[model samples]
Target chain A: MEAIYIILAGSLVAVSCGLVGSYLILRKMAMVADAISHAVLPGIVIAFFISGSRDSLPMLLGAGALGIITTFLIEFFHKKGNLQTDASIGVTFTWLFALGVILISTFAGKVDLDQDCVLYGEIAYVPIDLWITDTGTIMGPRVLYISGSVLLVVIAFIFIGYKELFLTTFDPSYAAIIGINTTLWHYLLMGAVSLTTVASFESVGAILVVALLIAPPATAYLLTEDFKKMLIFTCIIGIIVSVLGYYLASYIDGSIAGAMSTVAGLIFLVVFLFSPTQGVVFRNRRSKLSMTLNEEPI
Target chain B: MEDFLYFFSFQDPNIRYVVVGSVLLAISAAIVGCFTFLKKRALIGDAVAHSVLPGVCLAFVVSGTKNPIYLIIGAFITGWLSLRFIDMIVRYSKLKEDTAIGLTLSVFFGLGILILTAIQHSGNANQSGLDQFLFGKAASLVGQDLIVFGSVSIILLLVVGLLFKELTLLAFDEQFGKAIGMPVKGLELVLTTLTVLAVVTGIQAVGVVLMAAMLITPAAAARFWTDKLTTMVFLAALFGAISGVSGAYISFVAPAMPTGPWIVLVISFIAMSSFFIAPRKGILYKQFQQRKYQKQILEENILKAFFHLGEADEQYYGHRKISDLISQRRFVMGRLKGGLQKLVRSGFLKQDREGWVLTEEGKNKGQRIVKLHRLWELYLTEYLRIAPDHVHDEAETIEHIITPEIEARLEKKLNYPSVDPHNETIPYR
Candidate 1:
């Protein structure tokens, strides 16, 4: 029962992150996602300090706002200050993350969060931190409800904005010509990414959230040319990673989030080398075959 | 107050070690950062920083002790491997650079965490201080750590100095360096090694996460102040050293505070300020220059409108109504009114009951603008062979920017043309 709950928690995070990450990688905003994952640290800490509670709503709102601000700062620096996109991302996220770490250290006693927890997360505790009602009814686990609702919200967002998101990701100029609000959709997508990131931060840690956000989508991208198919593959890969990663963690008696990301990386490596359509090994072999055929004048 | 004095006095050996080690680590990272910044691979430093953790854990597990040398070696190996993996992915796959970096960084960090937690559960008592690489332990820098940091800094500095020219060429133009027979590939490898070394040494002070700031923030801030490579490198080093000392002093004053984040915060503050206020390239300066240029373009357009009106009637000094000027060319009403009033104040125009007329000084300026406009149109049609109709919009923008030197050169180039491609007389003072 505990193993089921833990895997459910991990799968919930993996699915949400994988869905949003599909759009992120499609739009070439993977680093921006990474930046937001780290930059939202201060927002969570500040939210905790102000609300004096570990309630999900306040933390999500705070982290969501910071995530938006992180994107805005990166864009502002790139467009206004003439800084390169990479430097803009590096400078903005590190600064905000540093601020967050400092905030946590200063209120070390008041805040229940620690640097280690933020780095690797405590996914094993998912089955332990139960959600109970005022009527003395016991809920299975808080992480499941939190992550499940988030997955639902992400699904709803994708379903409703499918056309707008698709057009904006593939062809922004055409989308603009057709009178779609590209900037609005961009911010909305970023907002969704941030929401997913903050929600998963508890189960997967901030950095590993990036693995779930990037690796599965990237692997899915290699397997197909169709965007919808890519997204579906990403969710499937996400589930596989969670289940396999959980077992790997238990086998090694190590951090579950860490094992999950390691599995994510391993899966990507396999797909990266073996995907029939896009694999490097197959590509080199195909080229060699073509070269020989040309030389032989067949 | 006494604490501040005691901290700075370097009287205590512990404080001395912390301050010197931090400054050295910062200076080396900052110097390497300038090269990465120029190459626009600043985020690569962040990837290398995150990738070092697994290496650190692996070294500890093998050695069964906290040996600085073994840890540094482990960190450098993984850090370098991460860069290689990113390069390989980008070269072989359709994934872009950003995706490759994010994937590599997170996966390596995740592996590191897995090993670190495994080590902790192994009941290794020596693993107590191993986690310090996550948030850094600048305040706990003992003499042994200082020696490691000092030697690494010296090695980094020496390599950077020796290969300064080759690295600069590699950063600015790799293809050009290759064309000139320079060993561009070899230089890139050397620079990559130096970057790994810098991150490995600096992580002990600022930790793995904020180490990116030590590499990138100082270089970014220094970039706002200069265009020369040498000057930028020096300024970045100076800024890095300042932040390092400040971080050490801050932790000294507040024992509860962590050194790494404060160091990052101070450097970020410096960078943010530089972005806003540094001369020439700073945001405020650019905004100011843009506003001034906009005003000049407005005033010049009004002058050109007056010159066009006078040319239509063969009355250069005749008064023209504001409505007539708008009919000639479009202008925002409020901006036009303000521009007209400002022109009057500057003695460029005279107002009377009928409308406004160009003064003697304004007539020459207006005529010069019209001449430059017609001259550019002719130059484009004759030299570049652009269509006559296409030249108007291009000349309209170029006329505002053409300096007197370019105007004279254009006249000489065109052999003093009298009529533009549109058959309008090229006005002259």
Candidate 2:
């Protein structure tokens, strides 16, 4: 039963991250999501300090604010300092993440937060931190509810704004010309990324969260060119990889997050080598320029 | 203060190993980081730093002991492989470099965690301090660890020193290097290996995650201080050593603190300060230059404004009211007043109760300014085929910046034309 709950939580986190990650990959902002996952550390620490507990709402808001700041600082360095995008990202996240680690060790030493927890979160222990009610009623895993609701909100958001998101993501100018609020939608997507990242941080930690966010969407991208089909493929692949990863972890009794990421990577590797159209072997036979013909101009 | 004395004094032989290991690691990381920064592969350091974890775990799993040599070898293998994987993904797939790097880094790190967790569950007694690889425990830099770090640092530094010229050529212009038959690819491989070696050696000191900063930040900070490659490398090494030793010292003083974050924090502080304070490239320097340029442009425009006023009359050098200059040129009242006062102090203008007038000396200076403007305007219209109307705005900006050499060139190029395309007199001194 605990395994089932853990798997369900993993699946939910994967789906939410994968769905949001597809858009991130399309926008060429996958690493920005990576930055948010790490930069939110101080936010979570501050939220934990202020609330004196890991209440989901305050933590969400804190991580969300930091996520926005991360984007702003990346843009700030890229535009103002004239650093390359990758260099700006490298500087901002490492600085923020280092600060976060220092804060946790300094102030939150009393709390359960430790280097182990931050590096590799124990998803297997999620079932232990149950959401119990008064009079001995077992509600569910706290992460399940948090991540499940996030998954629902993400689904609803993507559903309601499908056309707008599709247009803005593929071509923002076209979306704006067609009267869509592209900037608003851009922030909306970033908001969803922040929320999903925070919700998954406890289950998989920062590094694995990045893996889950980039790997599945990247794998699905190799399988198809249709955006809608790509989204569906991502969620399906995310769920499959999460379930497989859980079993692999159980078999080896290792980290679920680690196992899940490894599984996602394995899936990517197979597709990278053997996908029908975009596989490495197939593309190797063709000219290098031919492979890039379908790609959007950088 | 006592703790500082003890740490710096190195009374304990163990402290010597820790401090020495950290300093060597810092020097090596900084030296190799120069090439990485120049190559625009700074983030690859982060990726390889994370990816080396699996190799460490695999080494521990294979060797069943905490041998630093085995771990280094393991790390090198995986680190090297991750770089290949990233390059392959970028070359073969439609995914961009950032995505490939993110994917490769996290996935390799995830594999490392899985192996690490499996090892932990296996209940090895030596598994203690293995978790230190995450955030690093510098206190564990014992005898054997120092040997590994010291030897690797020496080798990497030696290689960098030997290949400096080749590496610089590869970094600055790869195609040029290849065109000159300099074996660019081989040089790049050597640099990448050195980067991996630096990362592997530094991992025990700063851990996997923060190691990238050590690899990149010192070089970034040094870049602000100099444009010369050799000077930048030396400064970067100096900065890296300071941060490293200080980080280890602080971690020793505060038992709860990890060394990696402290090192990162210190280096980031250096980098941030350099960004704001370095002489030529710093933000403050640029801001000062911009302000000086703005003042120069404003003063020049005021001279032009006075010359324009003098143009309206044949004999009068024109004492114009501040309001009239403000109305004519759209100058702000306070700013225009400041420009007039500055010009008066410089003897370019004379201020009276009625208004301001160009001094006799100022008239010649104004004539020179008006001459450059009209010369550029004429050059644009007559030589470059620009319309008479379009040349005004171009010449307005160009008039302030035209060097005497460029002004001379324009006059020669335009054949010493006496009047602009607008048929206005081209004043010449």
Candidate 3:
């Protein structure tokens, strides 16, 4: 009975992560998200230190705020500084993350936080303290409610901005020329991603959270370029993997998040290699030169 | 300080274990990283570092404890799997290689996190210490660890040494290597395995977050100092070993210092040095050489100009009244004065009681500069697709820097035309 609830919670987290992850993957922000995840550690630590508690409100707010800050800083450095985008992303987040680790080591030792806690969290055990109480009937873990609410917010965020988001992501210049606020859309996209990542951190932890945010949507993208189809495919893949990953974790005493991601990674591999529509051969050929040419223009 | 240095020698059994272990692994990883850095997959090492976590976790689970052998096996398995998955995503999906790397990296790292949290909850002290694998605990390394690492290091080195020729060719020009019937895929796999092994070896000393540096920065730093692959490999090994031992020594001597960040700090220092300070290609050196060349060209041009004025008038055209001519000659006056005085002593110029004069030799030299400058301007306007008025600035620089080889190539490619685009006469050498 409890296992069913764990599956629901896990699936909810997976779908939420995957949906927003599509945007991140499309924008090549997966690594940026990875960096943001680490950078938020210090924020969460500071919040916990202030509140002297591990509950949702302060930690969630703390992490979310820092996540947004990390997003802005990464974008800021890439735009303003001389470093290339990837290098900027790497430097900002790693430095911030290292600072977070050092802080945890120095000050948060009294707290239950460590780099391990930052890396891993057990969703099945989340039910130990968080049980749903409805009409005096004990029900799902409370994480489902929190993650589900955040997921709904994310879904609404995506729903409202779908066309605008697509336009900005696909062709920012065209969107700008057509009078769409591409800059606003970019921030909105980043804000949504950061919030979802922070909300899911305790349920899945920071390190593996990137896999959820990236792999599924990428897998779906390989399956099709149609945004609507891609979203649907990604959500479905997330749910399926959530259930399978949970079972594998339970049966083998392995990690649910790890299993799902590895499975997702495997699915991504198959699609990557075998996708008839968008395979390596096409990409390789295209890069070699323009079409209908006997040889490249040396 | 003297006592510290004396004790720091690997001759002591305690110091021996740490130094030898670090040095051997450093040598192995540095050599592998050299190839990856050249391939421009430097950040893939970063991705692979984060991607091996879940495997390490699973290894613990499979062994029902934090067994080193099982953990290494688990880490290796997942490392290979992660690399394969990343490759597939990049190959098969619409995602860029960066995206795939980012995705796989996060997912694997997150999974590792999940398992570790579960282990912590299970009340395993052994599991708790496994967290150090993420950042490293170099101080705990002992003789047993050294033996294990030393054996693996030797094996890895031998394999790489035997396969160096193929690896170099594969790195330098993949198509050429494949054309020569080299097993590209097989060699690539071997390279990947070596890279993963390097990352794994580093996790013990530098930790996961900083492992990429141990793999990439040494090689990057080494490249600045050498062009030979052999020298680069040797230098990278030296840098890597130095960083590893420095971090280890710091941790050993100072009880609370973590090894990973220190190692990273050292490697970053090396990278910074390579970027600005390596000889020949160093920014300061190049700028210095360029300045020197410009000065030489200016002096030569000035000498030629004075001679032209002299020849055109058959007098020391040193009309002290023409300030523009004097200013134009200002740049080269110092060097040209020496040549001028000799010309006067040998009676090539007469003191006109004005300013200065040039002999016939100076006249001819000045004529060549004027001729070369006009010819280049004409060439730019003609075959090289420059606008008529756009010829001056480029000619100014090219007149200073154009090499003999390029001059020959320009002459031939332009079809040896007698007149330039601007209708200037061609001066054939």
Candidate 4:
């Protein structure tokens, strides 16, 4: 029964990331999401210093605000400084992450966050930190509550703003010409990304969060061309990898997030080499078959 | 101050290894990073840094020891594989380079975590310091580690020194290198191999986490100071060595602090300061240039205004009221007053009870301004086919910047026109 709760918690985080990540992959801004995931470390540390508790509203808000600021700083460097997009993203995130690490080390005793948690995360302990009501009712894991709420928020954002997001991601100039607020949609997507990263940070550390955010959508991208199908495929891949990764970690007594990301990578590798239409094997086989057919005609 | 003295005095033999190891690591990474930075493959360094984790872990698992040599070999192999995979993905798939890098980096790091945690769970005591590879612990710089790092660093430095011209050509123009039959692909392979070796060599000092910073930040900071390849590479290595030694010393003073993050923070500070303060290309330098241009534009505009005012009257040296001059140009009162004072100080204008007027020298200078403006307008209209009405704004900007040589060329090209396209007189000097 506890295993069921853990699976649910992992799936919620994975699906939320998958939903937001689908848009990120389509926008060709997967790296910005990676930047946000790492940049939020300083925000989390500062939030912990203020709240003095593992669970607090200030932590979430701080992470959200810093995530947006990370976006703004990357844009500033990429535009104002005339840097390559990857370079700007690289410079900003590494600086923020280094600062966060320094702060964590300096205040090691005061801060509940540790370097290990920042890297591999404590998702297996999620089921242990449960929330109980006044009536002695077990309300499942609190992480499930946070991550599930974030998933609903992300789904609502995508559902309500689907047309605007689609138009902006595919053709921003056209969206602007048609009177849609393209910048507003962009910030909205970034906002969803920040919220999703914060919600998932506890379940998967900063490093593996990048994998969850990129791998599923990237794999689904190889399998399909339709946008809607891509989103669905990413969610399915995300949930399966989460469950599979949990069991793999349990079997090997390893970090659940790491195992999950490894599983996600394995899934991508499979799709990369063996997808029916886009796989290298099939593409090669098709070419060979065409050659043989032509030779038979001769 | 005492701690600083003790660190630099090198009284402790252990400290000597750390200082020497860090400087070598810094030089190798920075020199290799210069080429990577110039090639616009900066993020590949990040990918390689992260991808080295599995190699380190596998090296430990295979050897059953935490030896630096095996770990470095493992790191190089995986790091090289990551780059090859990235190139292959970009060539074959529709996904972009950033996506491929993010994917490969995260996947390899995740696998490393899996192996590392598995090793930890097995209750292996030797695996205690293995976690240091993640964030790096420079105090663990044993003599053997320093030897490996130092020798590899020397090899990297020598290769970069010998092939300086070839590497520069490959960085700036790959097509040209190929056109010249310079074995461009083989040179690229050598550079990639060196980048992997540099990152692997530095992993024990800065750790896998911040190795990318060690690799790229010094080169990036050095870019602000020079345009020449040799100068940039040398400056980058110097900056790298400085940051590395200082960072190692910092950890010595504050025993609790990690050396990798300190080095990264120091290099980041250097890069940020360079961005704002370096000569020629720094933000402050560019701002100064812009301000100078703006001031020159104001001075030339004032002279042109005086010339226009004098053109209407038969007496070219007559007095004009300060209020009249301000109204003609419609500049703010404060700025106009400052310009008038500056002209008077330079003996170009005089301020008497009547108001303001150009001096004998000022009249000649003002006439020259009007002549350049009208000449540019004529050049724009007659030669460039611009309408006479559209040339004023163009001439207004060009009048301040056109040197006497360019002015002479314009005169020769336009056959020394007597008037502009607007039929205004082209005053002679």
Q: How many residue pairs clash in each candidate?
A: 0, 0, 8, 0
Tens-digit lDDT track of model 3 for B1-429: 864786586567777677677777777878998898777777778788876777887888778876566776787888888888778766655578888788778667756665765675677666766877888767666766666657777888888899999999878899999998999999999999998888777677777776766776687678768789999999999888887787777667755655776666666676556646678755456667777876567555665566555545656345432354565455445656654555557654545767555556655555556556666877777767789888877776676666667766766766766775566555444
Point out where model 3 deviates above 4 Å.
A1-20, A28-100, A108-113, A121-168, A171-204, A232-298, B1-12, B64-67, B91-96, B123-128, B254-258, B280-373, B381-397, B403-429
Where is model 1 more than 4 Å wrong at Cα?
A: A173-180, A274-298, B308-334, B350-357, B378-391, B409-426
Candidate 1 lDDT over B144-235, as tens digits, reads 77898789999999999999999999999999999999988889899899999999998887889789999999999999999999999999
Q: Which stretches of candidate 4 lie over 4 Å from their true place?
A: A78-82, A132-138, A289-298, B313-323, B330-334
What are the per-residue Cα lDDT tens digits for candidate 3 across A185-290?
Answer: 8777777776777777776777777778887888898888688999999999999878887887776566677667767766776666567677676666765666
lDDT (tens digit, per residue) of candidate 4 on B1-429: 888888889999999988888888898999999999999998899889989998999899999998888988999999999999889777767788888888888888888888889889989888988988887777778688888878989999899889999999999999999998999999999999999999898887788877888877888888889989889999999999998898778767877777788888888888878877888877777789898887767776777778788787766777888676776687777877788888899998888988787888888887877899999999888878998889898887777888889989999999999988889889987
Ranking by DockQ: 1, 2, 4, 3
In angstroms, how far off is A9's CA in candidate 4?
A: 2.1
Q: Which runs of model 2 end up more than 4 angstroms from their true locations?
A: A132-138, A173-183, A282-298, B314-316
lDDT by residue (tens digit), candidate 2, A79-102? 755666776778778888999999
- The lowest-lDDT stretch of 10 consecutive residues in candidate 1 chain B is B136-145
Write candidate 2's Cα lDDT for B1-429 as tens digits. 888898899998988888888989999998898888988988999999999999999999999988999999999999999999999999989998888998999999999999999999999999987878878778788887888789999988888888889998988999998888888778878988998999999888899988888888898889889989999999999999999898778778986788898889899899888878898788788889999999999998888788887887664476788776765688877888898899999999998887888898888877888999888888887778888889889888888888889988888888888888888899776
RMSD of 4: 2.2
Taking the tens digit of each residue's C-alpha lDDT, what string does model 4 give over A1-298? Answer: 7778778888998898988888888788887888899889889889989888777477788888789888887787566455567666777788888888998998899988898888888888888988888999998788888888999999999999999999999999999999999989989898888888888888888888899999999999999999999999999999999899999988988888889989999999899889888887897899899989989955
| Best prediction by TM-score | 4
The worst-scoring run of ten residues by lDDT in candidate 3 chain B lies at B316-325
DockQ for each model:
0.80, 0.66, 0.23, 0.66
Ranking under lDDT, best-scoring first? Answer: 1, 2, 4, 3
